[model samples]
Target: MAVSLWHKKVIFFGGKGGVGKTTCSASFGLLAAKRGLRTLVVSTDPAHSLGDIFATHIDEEGQLAPNLWGYEINPVKESERYTEQIKSQFQNVVSPVIMEEIQRQIEAAYSAPGSEEAAIFDKFIDMLERIETEFDLVVFDTAPTGHTLRLLSLPELLASWIEHLIAQREKANRLMSMAAVGSPELKEKTDKPDPVLATLKRREERFRRAREFIVDNQAASFIFVVNAEKLPIMETQKAMEILVKYQIPIGGVIVNRLLPTDQEGPFWTRRRELEKKYMAEIEEQFGSLILAKLPLLPDDIYGRQALDQIVQMLEEQIID
Candidate 1:
Protein backbone atom coordinates (compact mmCIF):
# COMPACT_ATOMS: atom_id res chain seq x y z
CA MET A 1 0.00 0.00 0.00
CA ALA A 2 1.06 3.55 -0.67
CA VAL A 3 1.85 5.83 2.28
CA SER A 4 -0.92 8.36 2.64
CA LEU A 5 -1.00 11.56 4.69
CA TRP A 6 -4.65 12.30 4.05
CA HIS A 7 -5.88 11.49 7.53
CA LYS A 8 -2.98 12.14 9.91
CA LYS A 9 -1.75 15.60 10.79
CA VAL A 10 1.42 14.60 12.68
CA ILE A 11 3.67 11.75 11.50
CA PHE A 12 6.56 10.24 13.46
CA PHE A 13 9.27 8.19 11.76
CA GLY A 14 10.96 5.93 14.32
CA GLY A 15 12.91 2.72 14.18
CA LYS A 16 16.20 1.08 15.16
CA GLY A 17 19.22 3.34 15.01
CA GLY A 18 20.90 3.61 11.56
CA VAL A 19 17.75 2.54 9.72
CA GLY A 20 17.70 5.70 7.52
CA LYS A 21 14.88 7.29 9.50
CA THR A 22 16.41 10.71 8.95
CA THR A 23 16.50 10.27 5.16
CA CYS A 24 12.98 8.92 4.86
CA SER A 25 11.57 11.59 7.16
CA ALA A 26 13.25 14.37 5.19
CA SER A 27 11.86 12.94 1.96
CA PHE A 28 8.35 12.85 3.39
CA GLY A 29 8.63 16.42 4.67
CA LEU A 30 9.75 17.64 1.23
CA LEU A 31 6.98 15.66 -0.39
CA ALA A 32 4.43 17.21 1.92
CA ALA A 33 5.69 20.69 1.13
CA LYS A 34 5.64 20.00 -2.64
CA ARG A 35 2.06 18.90 -2.27
CA GLY A 36 1.35 22.47 -1.03
CA LEU A 37 1.01 21.60 2.64
CA ARG A 38 2.99 23.63 5.14
CA THR A 39 5.43 21.14 6.68
CA LEU A 40 7.95 20.95 9.51
CA VAL A 41 10.65 18.29 9.75
CA VAL A 42 11.80 17.86 13.33
CA SER A 43 14.66 15.75 14.68
CA THR A 44 14.29 14.49 18.24
CA ASP A 45 17.42 12.36 18.07
CA PRO A 46 20.41 13.65 19.98
CA ALA A 47 22.57 12.91 16.93
CA HIS A 48 21.04 15.38 14.53
CA SER A 49 20.96 14.59 10.77
CA LEU A 50 18.17 16.69 9.25
CA GLY A 51 20.57 19.57 8.62
CA ASP A 52 23.09 17.17 7.04
CA ILE A 53 20.41 15.69 4.79
CA PHE A 54 19.30 19.12 3.58
CA ALA A 55 22.91 20.29 3.27
CA THR A 56 21.81 23.43 5.09
CA HIS A 57 21.15 24.67 8.61
CA ILE A 58 18.25 23.69 10.85
CA ASP A 59 17.64 25.61 14.03
CA GLU A 60 14.93 26.84 16.40
CA GLU A 61 13.42 28.97 13.63
CA GLY A 62 13.19 25.80 11.47
CA GLN A 63 13.44 27.21 7.90
CA LEU A 64 15.01 24.59 5.59
CA ALA A 65 12.86 24.69 2.45
CA PRO A 66 10.24 26.75 0.64
CA ASN A 67 7.22 25.27 2.34
CA LEU A 68 9.06 23.33 5.00
CA TRP A 69 10.77 24.08 8.31
CA GLY A 70 13.20 22.00 10.39
CA TYR A 71 14.16 21.78 14.04
CA GLU A 72 16.62 19.61 15.96
CA ILE A 73 16.10 19.69 19.71
CA ASN A 74 19.22 19.27 21.78
CA PRO A 75 18.16 17.45 24.93
CA VAL A 76 20.80 19.04 27.11
CA LYS A 77 19.72 22.55 26.10
CA GLU A 78 16.06 21.62 26.50
CA SER A 79 16.71 20.21 29.97
CA GLU A 80 18.38 23.46 30.99
CA ARG A 81 15.40 25.42 29.70
CA TYR A 82 13.00 23.16 31.59
CA THR A 83 14.96 23.51 34.82
CA GLU A 84 15.02 27.28 34.51
CA GLN A 85 11.28 27.36 33.94
CA ILE A 86 10.73 25.36 37.09
CA LYS A 87 13.09 27.52 39.13
CA SER A 88 11.49 30.72 37.90
CA GLN A 89 8.01 29.49 38.73
CA PHE A 90 8.90 28.37 42.25
CA GLN A 91 11.69 30.72 43.41
CA ASN A 92 9.31 33.54 44.35
CA VAL A 93 7.04 31.54 46.63
CA VAL A 94 9.53 29.37 48.53
CA SER A 95 11.90 30.60 51.25
CA PRO A 96 15.52 31.62 50.72
CA VAL A 97 16.79 28.42 52.40
CA ILE A 98 14.46 26.19 50.41
CA MET A 99 15.21 28.18 47.24
CA GLU A 100 18.94 27.51 47.59
CA GLU A 101 18.30 23.81 48.12
CA ILE A 102 15.99 23.62 45.09
CA GLN A 103 18.62 25.37 43.00
CA ARG A 104 21.23 22.80 44.06
CA GLN A 105 18.93 19.89 43.22
CA ILE A 106 17.98 21.31 39.83
CA GLU A 107 21.63 21.83 38.95
CA ALA A 108 22.44 18.31 40.08
CA ALA A 109 19.67 17.04 37.74
CA TYR A 110 21.49 18.19 34.59
CA SER A 111 22.49 14.62 33.90
CA ALA A 112 19.59 12.93 35.69
CA PRO A 113 18.24 9.70 34.24
CA GLY A 114 14.95 11.08 32.83
CA SER A 115 15.71 14.80 32.78
CA GLU A 116 16.37 14.93 29.05
CA GLU A 117 13.27 12.98 28.17
CA ALA A 118 11.14 15.13 30.46
CA ALA A 119 12.38 18.27 28.79
CA ILE A 120 12.01 16.84 25.30
CA PHE A 121 8.55 15.57 26.10
CA ASP A 122 7.54 19.05 27.24
CA LYS A 123 8.69 20.48 23.89
CA PHE A 124 6.92 17.70 22.03
CA ILE A 125 3.70 18.60 23.85
CA ASP A 126 4.12 22.20 22.75
CA MET A 127 4.56 21.06 19.15
CA LEU A 128 1.49 18.85 19.26
CA GLU A 129 -0.57 21.71 20.63
CA ARG A 130 0.54 24.14 17.91
CA ILE A 131 1.05 21.85 14.90
CA GLU A 132 -2.36 22.45 13.30
CA THR A 133 -2.13 26.19 13.73
CA GLU A 134 1.46 26.30 12.48
CA PHE A 135 1.71 23.62 9.76
CA ASP A 136 -0.35 21.15 7.80
CA LEU A 137 2.11 18.37 8.41
CA VAL A 138 4.78 17.83 11.11
CA VAL A 139 7.11 14.87 10.57
CA PHE A 140 9.20 13.79 13.53
CA ASP A 141 12.43 11.89 13.01
CA THR A 142 12.76 10.44 16.49
CA ALA A 143 15.59 8.74 18.38
CA PRO A 144 16.40 5.03 18.41
CA THR A 145 13.62 2.59 19.31
CA GLY A 146 14.57 2.05 22.97
CA HIS A 147 15.04 5.72 23.69
CA THR A 148 11.91 6.67 21.78
CA LEU A 149 9.84 4.06 23.58
CA ARG A 150 11.03 5.39 26.90
CA LEU A 151 10.05 8.87 25.73
CA LEU A 152 6.55 7.71 24.77
CA SER A 153 5.99 6.11 28.15
CA LEU A 154 7.17 9.17 30.08
CA PRO A 155 3.72 10.63 30.68
CA GLU A 156 2.57 7.56 32.57
CA LEU A 157 5.67 7.48 34.73
CA LEU A 158 5.79 11.22 35.34
CA ALA A 159 2.12 11.47 36.13
CA SER A 160 2.43 8.82 38.80
CA TRP A 161 5.45 10.54 40.27
CA ILE A 162 3.67 13.90 40.29
CA GLU A 163 0.65 12.36 42.00
CA HIS A 164 2.83 10.94 44.72
CA LEU A 165 4.49 14.31 45.23
CA ILE A 166 1.13 16.02 45.42
CA ALA A 167 -0.04 13.56 48.04
CA GLN A 168 3.08 14.12 50.10
CA ARG A 169 2.76 17.90 49.77
CA GLU A 170 -0.85 17.73 50.95
CA LYS A 171 0.14 15.74 53.97
CA ALA A 172 2.84 18.27 54.81
CA ASN A 173 0.40 21.14 54.35
CA ARG A 174 -2.02 19.47 56.78
CA LEU A 175 0.77 19.08 59.26
CA MET A 176 1.74 22.72 58.85
CA SER A 177 -1.82 23.87 59.50
CA MET A 178 -2.06 21.70 62.61
CA ALA A 179 1.20 23.08 63.99
CA ALA A 180 0.57 26.78 63.14
CA VAL A 181 -3.15 27.38 62.83
CA GLY A 182 -4.37 24.54 65.12
CA SER A 183 -6.78 23.12 62.50
CA PRO A 184 -6.06 20.42 59.92
CA GLU A 185 -9.00 21.64 57.77
CA LEU A 186 -7.37 25.08 57.47
CA LYS A 187 -5.07 23.76 54.76
CA GLU A 188 -8.08 22.82 52.64
CA LYS A 189 -9.74 26.21 53.10
CA THR A 190 -6.57 28.21 52.65
CA ASP A 191 -6.80 31.87 51.67
CA LYS A 192 -4.40 31.41 48.75
CA PRO A 193 -3.89 28.56 46.30
CA ASP A 194 -0.72 26.48 46.48
CA PRO A 195 1.26 27.53 43.46
CA VAL A 196 3.62 24.55 43.78
CA LEU A 197 0.77 22.05 43.62
CA ALA A 198 -0.87 24.11 40.89
CA THR A 199 2.28 23.93 38.75
CA LEU A 200 2.64 20.19 39.14
CA LYS A 201 -1.02 19.58 38.24
CA ARG A 202 -0.69 21.82 35.21
CA ARG A 203 2.28 19.76 34.02
CA GLU A 204 0.36 16.55 34.59
CA GLU A 205 -2.52 17.92 32.50
CA ARG A 206 -0.13 18.81 29.68
CA PHE A 207 1.24 15.27 29.64
CA ARG A 208 -2.27 13.87 29.47
CA ARG A 209 -3.12 16.08 26.51
CA ALA A 210 -0.02 15.00 24.62
CA ARG A 211 -0.75 11.35 25.38
CA GLU A 212 -4.30 11.77 24.09
CA PHE A 213 -3.09 13.44 20.91
CA ILE A 214 -0.52 10.73 20.23
CA VAL A 215 -3.08 7.93 20.62
CA ASP A 216 -5.47 9.64 18.25
CA ASN A 217 -5.04 8.48 14.63
CA GLN A 218 -6.37 11.73 13.18
CA ALA A 219 -4.01 13.70 15.39
CA ALA A 220 -0.80 11.65 15.13
CA SER A 221 0.51 8.48 13.46
CA PHE A 222 3.73 6.57 14.17
CA ILE A 223 5.63 4.94 11.29
CA PHE A 224 8.37 2.41 11.82
CA VAL A 225 11.27 2.36 9.36
CA VAL A 226 13.03 -0.97 9.19
CA ASN A 227 15.56 -2.74 7.03
CA ALA A 228 14.89 -6.40 6.22
CA GLU A 229 17.43 -7.87 8.62
CA LYS A 230 17.54 -9.77 11.90
CA LEU A 231 18.26 -7.03 14.42
CA PRO A 232 16.17 -4.32 12.78
CA ILE A 233 13.22 -6.67 12.37
CA MET A 234 13.36 -7.87 15.98
CA GLU A 235 13.65 -4.34 17.33
CA THR A 236 10.85 -3.00 15.12
CA GLN A 237 8.55 -5.85 16.14
CA LYS A 238 9.11 -5.09 19.82
CA ALA A 239 8.58 -1.37 19.22
CA MET A 240 5.29 -2.03 17.43
CA GLU A 241 4.03 -4.13 20.33
CA ILE A 242 4.95 -1.46 22.90
CA LEU A 243 3.36 1.36 20.90
CA VAL A 244 0.21 -0.68 20.36
CA LYS A 245 0.04 -1.55 24.04
CA TYR A 246 0.05 2.16 24.79
CA GLN A 247 -2.78 2.61 22.27
CA ILE A 248 -0.66 4.81 20.09
CA PRO A 249 -1.70 4.19 16.51
CA ILE A 250 0.85 2.78 14.09
CA GLY A 251 0.44 4.15 10.56
CA GLY A 252 2.56 1.34 9.08
CA VAL A 253 6.08 0.05 8.59
CA ILE A 254 8.40 1.34 5.86
CA VAL A 255 10.75 -1.35 4.54
CA ASN A 256 13.81 0.73 3.66
CA ARG A 257 17.14 -0.18 2.05
CA LEU A 258 15.92 -3.30 0.26
CA LEU A 259 18.32 -5.11 -2.00
CA PRO A 260 18.39 -4.22 -5.69
CA THR A 261 15.87 -6.22 -7.76
CA ASP A 262 18.57 -7.30 -10.20
CA GLN A 263 22.11 -7.88 -8.96
CA GLU A 264 25.25 -9.76 -10.16
CA GLY A 265 27.87 -11.84 -8.30
CA PRO A 266 27.55 -14.51 -5.64
CA PHE A 267 27.74 -12.11 -2.65
CA TRP A 268 24.97 -9.88 -4.03
CA THR A 269 22.90 -12.98 -4.81
CA ARG A 270 23.29 -14.34 -1.32
CA ARG A 271 22.44 -10.95 0.24
CA ARG A 272 19.27 -10.74 -1.85
CA GLU A 273 18.24 -14.23 -0.78
CA LEU A 274 18.66 -13.32 2.88
CA GLU A 275 16.63 -10.13 2.33
CA LYS A 276 13.86 -12.14 0.68
CA LYS A 277 13.51 -14.39 3.71
CA TYR A 278 13.38 -11.45 6.12
CA MET A 279 11.07 -9.47 3.83
CA ALA A 280 8.71 -12.45 3.88
CA GLU A 281 8.95 -12.54 7.65
CA ILE A 282 8.11 -8.82 7.80
CA GLU A 283 5.06 -9.40 5.57
CA GLU A 284 3.90 -12.36 7.62
CA GLN A 285 4.38 -10.46 10.85
CA PHE A 286 2.97 -7.03 9.95
CA GLY A 287 0.53 -8.04 7.20
CA SER A 288 -1.42 -4.96 6.02
CA LEU A 289 0.74 -2.57 8.07
CA ILE A 290 3.64 -2.95 5.60
CA LEU A 291 3.36 0.35 3.77
CA ALA A 292 6.28 0.75 1.36
CA LYS A 293 9.46 -0.96 0.17
CA LEU A 294 12.40 1.23 -0.90
CA PRO A 295 15.45 -0.14 -2.71
CA LEU A 296 18.97 0.52 -1.57
CA LEU A 297 20.49 3.39 -3.53
CA PRO A 298 23.98 3.32 -4.99
CA ASP A 299 25.11 6.51 -3.26
CA ASP A 300 24.54 8.36 0.00
CA ILE A 301 21.23 10.26 0.13
CA TYR A 302 21.80 14.00 0.31
CA GLY A 303 20.23 17.36 -0.67
CA ARG A 304 16.88 18.21 -2.26
CA GLN A 305 17.18 16.52 -5.68
CA ALA A 306 17.94 13.07 -4.30
CA LEU A 307 15.18 13.47 -1.72
CA ASP A 308 12.83 14.46 -4.50
CA GLN A 309 13.40 11.11 -6.19
CA ILE A 310 12.60 9.33 -2.95
CA VAL A 311 9.42 11.39 -2.59
CA GLN A 312 8.37 10.27 -6.05
CA MET A 313 8.90 6.65 -5.12
CA LEU A 314 6.92 7.15 -1.92
CA GLU A 315 4.03 8.74 -3.80
CA GLU A 316 3.92 5.72 -6.09
CA GLN A 317 3.84 3.18 -3.25
CA ILE A 318 1.91 5.05 -0.50
CA ILE A 319 -1.78 4.31 -0.27
CA ASP A 320 -4.16 6.88 -1.67
Candidate 2:
Protein backbone atom coordinates (compact mmCIF):
# COMPACT_ATOMS: atom_id res chain seq x y z
CA MET A 1 0.00 0.00 0.00
CA ALA A 2 3.02 2.24 -0.23
CA VAL A 3 4.07 4.33 -3.22
CA SER A 4 7.27 3.45 -5.07
CA LEU A 5 10.12 5.94 -5.45
CA TRP A 6 9.29 6.27 -9.15
CA HIS A 7 5.97 7.70 -8.02
CA LYS A 8 7.61 10.02 -5.53
CA LYS A 9 7.17 13.78 -5.78
CA VAL A 10 10.85 14.53 -6.29
CA ILE A 11 13.31 12.90 -8.69
CA PHE A 12 16.97 13.39 -9.51
CA PHE A 13 18.70 12.54 -12.79
CA GLY A 14 22.45 12.04 -12.52
CA GLY A 15 25.31 10.10 -14.07
CA LYS A 16 28.74 10.51 -15.69
CA GLY A 17 29.34 13.58 -17.87
CA GLY A 18 27.83 13.60 -21.42
CA VAL A 19 25.21 10.98 -20.64
CA GLY A 20 22.24 13.15 -21.67
CA LYS A 21 21.19 13.97 -18.12
CA THR A 22 19.86 17.43 -18.92
CA THR A 23 17.83 16.32 -21.94
CA CYS A 24 16.34 13.34 -20.15
CA SER A 25 15.37 15.41 -17.12
CA ALA A 26 13.67 17.99 -19.34
CA SER A 27 11.60 15.35 -21.12
CA PHE A 28 10.58 13.80 -17.81
CA GLY A 29 9.45 17.14 -16.44
CA LEU A 30 7.49 18.04 -19.55
CA LEU A 31 5.75 14.68 -19.49
CA ALA A 32 4.89 14.91 -15.81
CA ALA A 33 3.51 18.41 -16.25
CA LYS A 34 1.52 17.34 -19.31
CA ARG A 35 -0.10 14.66 -17.19
CA GLY A 36 -1.53 17.52 -15.10
CA LEU A 37 1.12 17.58 -12.40
CA ARG A 38 2.62 20.94 -11.54
CA THR A 39 6.24 20.00 -12.12
CA LEU A 40 9.38 22.01 -11.64
CA VAL A 41 12.68 20.88 -13.14
CA VAL A 42 15.87 22.43 -11.78
CA SER A 43 19.48 22.20 -12.84
CA THR A 44 22.12 22.19 -10.12
CA ASP A 45 24.92 21.96 -12.69
CA PRO A 46 27.14 25.04 -12.89
CA ALA A 47 27.41 24.66 -16.65
CA HIS A 48 23.69 24.58 -17.20
CA SER A 49 22.35 23.01 -20.41
CA LEU A 50 18.82 22.80 -19.00
CA GLY A 51 17.94 26.22 -20.43
CA ASP A 52 19.19 25.22 -23.86
CA ILE A 53 17.33 21.92 -23.79
CA PHE A 54 14.01 23.55 -22.94
CA ALA A 55 14.67 26.26 -25.57
CA THR A 56 13.30 28.83 -23.14
CA HIS A 57 14.98 30.98 -20.58
CA ILE A 58 14.28 29.88 -17.02
CA ASP A 59 14.63 32.56 -14.39
CA GLU A 60 15.08 32.49 -10.61
CA GLU A 61 11.48 31.41 -10.15
CA GLY A 62 11.59 28.94 -13.13
CA GLN A 63 8.75 29.49 -15.61
CA LEU A 64 8.38 27.45 -18.81
CA ALA A 65 4.89 26.18 -19.50
CA PRO A 66 1.39 26.28 -18.07
CA ASN A 67 2.11 23.36 -15.77
CA LEU A 68 5.90 23.10 -16.01
CA TRP A 69 8.67 25.25 -14.49
CA GLY A 70 12.48 25.23 -14.65
CA TYR A 71 15.51 26.72 -12.92
CA GLU A 72 19.30 26.76 -13.32
CA ILE A 73 21.62 27.34 -10.37
CA ASN A 74 24.91 28.95 -11.48
CA PRO A 75 27.63 28.20 -8.91
CA VAL A 76 29.64 31.38 -9.41
CA LYS A 77 26.64 33.65 -9.02
CA GLU A 78 25.34 31.68 -6.04
CA SER A 79 28.77 31.78 -4.38
CA GLU A 80 28.90 35.55 -4.77
CA ARG A 81 25.42 35.94 -3.36
CA TYR A 82 26.13 33.63 -0.46
CA THR A 83 29.36 35.48 0.39
CA GLU A 84 27.67 38.87 0.20
CA GLN A 85 24.88 37.76 2.52
CA ILE A 86 27.39 36.53 5.07
CA LYS A 87 29.43 39.72 4.75
CA SER A 88 26.33 41.86 5.20
CA GLN A 89 25.45 39.98 8.36
CA PHE A 90 29.00 40.39 9.65
CA GLN A 91 28.86 44.15 9.13
CA ASN A 92 25.63 44.31 11.13
CA VAL A 93 27.07 42.24 14.01
CA VAL A 94 30.81 42.96 14.26
CA SER A 95 32.55 46.08 15.51
CA PRO A 96 33.46 48.79 12.96
CA VAL A 97 37.20 48.50 13.72
CA ILE A 98 37.17 44.75 12.85
CA MET A 99 34.96 45.03 9.72
CA GLU A 100 37.82 45.42 7.21
CA GLU A 101 39.70 42.35 8.48
CA ILE A 102 36.45 40.37 8.67
CA GLN A 103 35.62 41.29 5.06
CA ARG A 104 39.04 40.00 3.94
CA GLN A 105 38.50 36.78 5.85
CA ILE A 106 35.07 36.39 4.30
CA GLU A 107 36.52 36.86 0.82
CA ALA A 108 39.17 34.21 1.47
CA ALA A 109 36.60 31.77 2.82
CA TYR A 110 34.45 32.24 -0.27
CA SER A 111 37.39 31.26 -2.47
CA ALA A 112 38.13 28.10 -0.47
CA PRO A 113 37.39 24.68 -1.90
CA GLY A 114 33.86 23.43 -1.15
CA SER A 115 32.61 26.98 -0.54
CA GLU A 116 30.90 27.17 -3.95
CA GLU A 117 29.41 23.70 -3.48
CA ALA A 118 28.14 24.61 -0.04
CA ALA A 119 26.46 27.68 -1.51
CA ILE A 120 24.89 25.58 -4.28
CA PHE A 121 23.72 23.09 -1.69
CA ASP A 122 22.09 25.84 0.34
CA LYS A 123 20.08 26.84 -2.73
CA PHE A 124 19.39 23.18 -3.50
CA ILE A 125 17.89 22.70 -0.06
CA ASP A 126 15.82 25.84 -0.48
CA MET A 127 14.23 24.41 -3.65
CA LEU A 128 13.48 21.06 -1.98
CA GLU A 129 11.87 22.75 0.98
CA ARG A 130 9.68 24.88 -1.26
CA ILE A 131 8.45 21.97 -3.40
CA GLU A 132 5.89 20.89 -0.83
CA THR A 133 4.24 24.30 -0.85
CA GLU A 134 4.73 25.17 -4.50
CA PHE A 135 4.49 22.20 -6.86
CA ASP A 136 3.19 18.67 -7.32
CA LEU A 137 6.55 17.33 -8.43
CA VAL A 138 10.21 18.45 -8.58
CA VAL A 139 12.98 17.04 -10.74
CA PHE A 140 16.64 17.84 -10.33
CA ASP A 141 19.01 17.50 -13.28
CA THR A 142 22.20 17.19 -11.27
CA ALA A 143 25.88 17.53 -12.15
CA PRO A 144 28.08 14.49 -12.65
CA THR A 145 27.83 11.60 -10.20
CA GLY A 146 30.71 12.52 -7.88
CA HIS A 147 29.56 16.10 -7.36
CA THR A 148 26.00 15.00 -6.72
CA LEU A 149 27.13 12.38 -4.21
CA ARG A 150 29.05 15.01 -2.27
CA LEU A 151 26.11 17.39 -2.38
CA LEU A 152 23.76 14.71 -1.05
CA SER A 153 26.28 13.77 1.65
CA LEU A 154 26.61 17.34 2.92
CA PRO A 155 23.86 17.30 5.57
CA GLU A 156 25.69 14.71 7.63
CA LEU A 157 29.15 16.20 7.13
CA LEU A 158 28.14 19.85 7.65
CA ALA A 159 25.89 19.15 10.61
CA SER A 160 28.73 17.66 12.62
CA TRP A 161 31.04 20.50 11.63
CA ILE A 162 28.51 23.11 12.66
CA GLU A 163 27.88 21.38 15.97
CA HIS A 164 31.62 21.33 16.72
CA LEU A 165 31.91 25.01 15.84
CA ILE A 166 28.97 25.85 18.10
CA ALA A 167 30.48 23.87 20.97
CA GLN A 168 33.86 25.61 20.58
CA ARG A 169 32.19 29.02 20.51
CA GLU A 170 30.24 28.18 23.65
CA LYS A 171 33.41 27.10 25.42
CA ALA A 172 35.23 30.28 24.38
CA ASN A 173 32.31 32.46 25.56
CA ARG A 174 32.25 30.69 28.94
CA LEU A 175 35.99 31.16 29.30
CA MET A 176 35.65 34.87 28.53
CA SER A 177 32.91 35.28 31.12
CA MET A 178 35.01 33.45 33.72
CA ALA A 179 38.01 35.69 33.00
CA ALA A 180 35.82 38.82 33.17
CA VAL A 181 34.31 37.85 36.56
CA GLY A 182 33.42 41.32 37.87
CA SER A 183 33.33 43.28 34.58
CA PRO A 184 29.69 44.19 33.73
CA GLU A 185 30.47 44.92 30.03
CA LEU A 186 32.03 41.48 29.41
CA LYS A 187 29.34 39.72 31.52
CA GLU A 188 26.61 41.45 29.50
CA LYS A 189 28.31 40.37 26.25
CA THR A 190 28.56 36.74 27.40
CA ASP A 191 24.90 36.80 28.54
CA LYS A 192 23.76 37.71 24.99
CA PRO A 193 23.50 34.92 22.39
CA ASP A 194 26.37 34.52 19.92
CA PRO A 195 24.85 35.59 16.59
CA VAL A 196 27.44 33.70 14.56
CA LEU A 197 26.76 30.50 16.46
CA ALA A 198 23.03 31.09 16.08
CA THR A 199 23.44 31.39 12.32
CA LEU A 200 25.40 28.14 12.17
CA LYS A 201 22.78 26.33 14.23
CA ARG A 202 20.04 27.58 11.92
CA ARG A 203 21.96 26.26 8.93
CA GLU A 204 22.48 22.99 10.77
CA GLU A 205 18.75 22.66 11.31
CA ARG A 206 18.07 23.25 7.60
CA PHE A 207 20.56 20.52 6.68
CA ARG A 208 18.91 18.15 9.12
CA ARG A 209 15.53 18.69 7.46
CA ALA A 210 17.06 18.33 4.03
CA ARG A 211 18.57 14.99 5.02
CA GLU A 212 15.24 13.85 6.40
CA PHE A 213 13.44 14.76 3.19
CA ILE A 214 16.05 12.89 1.17
CA VAL A 215 16.64 9.77 3.26
CA ASP A 216 13.92 9.27 5.84
CA ASN A 217 10.74 10.35 4.06
CA GLN A 218 11.74 8.90 0.69
CA ALA A 219 10.52 12.07 -0.92
CA ALA A 220 13.43 12.15 -3.36
CA SER A 221 14.14 9.53 -6.01
CA PHE A 222 17.37 9.21 -8.03
CA ILE A 223 17.08 8.25 -11.70
CA PHE A 224 20.37 7.68 -13.43
CA VAL A 225 20.77 8.77 -17.07
CA VAL A 226 23.51 6.84 -18.80
CA ASN A 227 24.68 5.72 -22.23
CA ALA A 228 25.41 2.11 -23.18
CA GLU A 229 29.12 2.80 -23.14
CA LYS A 230 31.62 0.89 -20.97
CA LEU A 231 32.65 3.94 -19.00
CA PRO A 232 29.13 5.10 -18.32
CA ILE A 233 28.08 1.60 -17.31
CA MET A 234 30.98 1.27 -14.88
CA GLU A 235 30.49 4.77 -13.51
CA THR A 236 26.74 4.27 -13.09
CA GLN A 237 27.35 1.04 -11.22
CA LYS A 238 29.72 2.81 -8.84
CA ALA A 239 27.36 5.76 -8.39
CA MET A 240 24.42 3.47 -7.66
CA GLU A 241 26.48 1.68 -5.03
CA ILE A 242 27.32 5.00 -3.41
CA LEU A 243 23.67 6.01 -3.34
CA VAL A 244 22.78 2.68 -1.81
CA LYS A 245 25.48 3.18 0.83
CA TYR A 246 23.95 6.58 1.64
CA GLN A 247 20.45 5.01 1.80
CA ILE A 248 19.10 7.06 -1.10
CA PRO A 249 16.52 5.25 -3.22
CA ILE A 250 17.12 4.90 -6.94
CA GLY A 251 14.02 5.02 -9.12
CA GLY A 252 15.47 3.65 -12.35
CA VAL A 253 18.09 3.95 -15.10
CA ILE A 254 17.64 5.44 -18.57
CA VAL A 255 19.94 4.24 -21.36
CA ASN A 256 20.49 7.10 -23.76
CA ARG A 257 21.97 7.41 -27.32
CA LEU A 258 21.33 3.97 -28.74
CA LEU A 259 22.83 3.53 -32.21
CA PRO A 260 20.50 2.59 -35.05
CA THR A 261 19.52 -1.01 -35.61
CA ASP A 262 20.07 -0.96 -39.41
CA GLN A 263 23.62 -0.12 -40.47
CA GLU A 264 25.42 -0.24 -43.92
CA GLY A 265 29.17 0.55 -43.78
CA PRO A 266 32.07 -1.28 -42.10
CA PHE A 267 32.53 1.65 -39.70
CA TRP A 268 28.82 1.74 -38.81
CA THR A 269 28.78 -2.06 -38.60
CA ARG A 270 31.74 -2.13 -36.21
CA ARG A 271 30.26 0.68 -34.13
CA ARG A 272 26.97 -1.25 -33.94
CA GLU A 273 28.81 -4.35 -32.83
CA LEU A 274 30.54 -2.47 -30.02
CA GLU A 275 27.28 -0.81 -29.00
CA LYS A 276 25.54 -4.18 -28.90
CA LYS A 277 28.13 -5.56 -26.48
CA TYR A 278 27.78 -2.57 -24.15
CA MET A 279 24.02 -2.61 -24.44
CA ALA A 280 24.08 -6.26 -23.46
CA GLU A 281 26.24 -5.30 -20.48
CA ILE A 282 23.75 -2.62 -19.52
CA GLU A 283 20.94 -5.13 -19.68
CA GLU A 284 22.90 -7.64 -17.67
CA GLN A 285 23.71 -5.08 -15.01
CA PHE A 286 20.51 -3.06 -14.75
CA GLY A 287 17.77 -4.49 -16.94
CA SER A 288 15.25 -4.80 -14.13
CA LEU A 289 15.83 -1.16 -13.21
CA ILE A 290 15.82 0.15 -16.78
CA LEU A 291 13.01 2.64 -17.39
CA ALA A 292 13.62 3.72 -20.97
CA LYS A 293 16.18 3.50 -23.78
CA LEU A 294 16.35 6.50 -26.11
CA PRO A 295 17.83 6.32 -29.59
CA LEU A 296 20.57 8.52 -31.02
CA LEU A 297 18.56 10.97 -33.12
CA PRO A 298 20.02 11.98 -36.48
CA ASP A 299 19.50 15.66 -35.72
CA ASP A 300 20.29 17.30 -32.39
CA ILE A 301 17.06 17.15 -30.36
CA TYR A 302 15.74 20.65 -29.62
CA GLY A 303 12.56 22.75 -29.53
CA ARG A 304 9.05 21.73 -28.46
CA GLN A 305 8.43 19.16 -31.17
CA ALA A 306 11.61 17.16 -30.60
CA LEU A 307 11.11 17.23 -26.87
CA ASP A 308 7.47 16.29 -27.40
CA GLN A 309 8.64 13.06 -29.04
CA ILE A 310 10.70 12.31 -25.94
CA VAL A 311 7.75 13.12 -23.69
CA GLN A 312 5.55 10.88 -25.81
CA MET A 313 8.05 8.07 -25.39
CA LEU A 314 7.95 8.36 -21.61
CA GLU A 315 4.18 8.48 -21.57
CA GLU A 316 4.07 5.35 -23.72
CA GLN A 317 6.71 3.53 -21.70
CA ILE A 318 6.19 4.56 -18.09
CA ILE A 319 3.95 7.35 -16.85
CA ASP A 320 0.81 6.75 -18.90
lDDT of 2 by residue, 236-291 (tens): 99999988888888888998899988868999989998999998899999988898
Clashes found in each candidate (C-alpha, N, C closer than 3 A): 6, 0
- lDDT (10s digit) by residue, model 1, range 153-254: 887777788889989888877666666575557645564678887887888788888878777776688999999999999999899889989888898889
The candidate scoring highest on lDDT is 2
User: How well does each candidate superpose onto the true structure, as a TM-score?
Assistant: 0.92, 0.93
Task: State the displacement of the C-alpha of residue 76, model 2, in Å, after optimal TM-score superposition.
Answer: 1.5
Report residue 243 deviation for candidate 2 (angstroms): 1.1
Query: Model 2, residue 280: what's the lDDT?
Result: 89
Q: lDDT, candidate 1, residue 85? A: 90
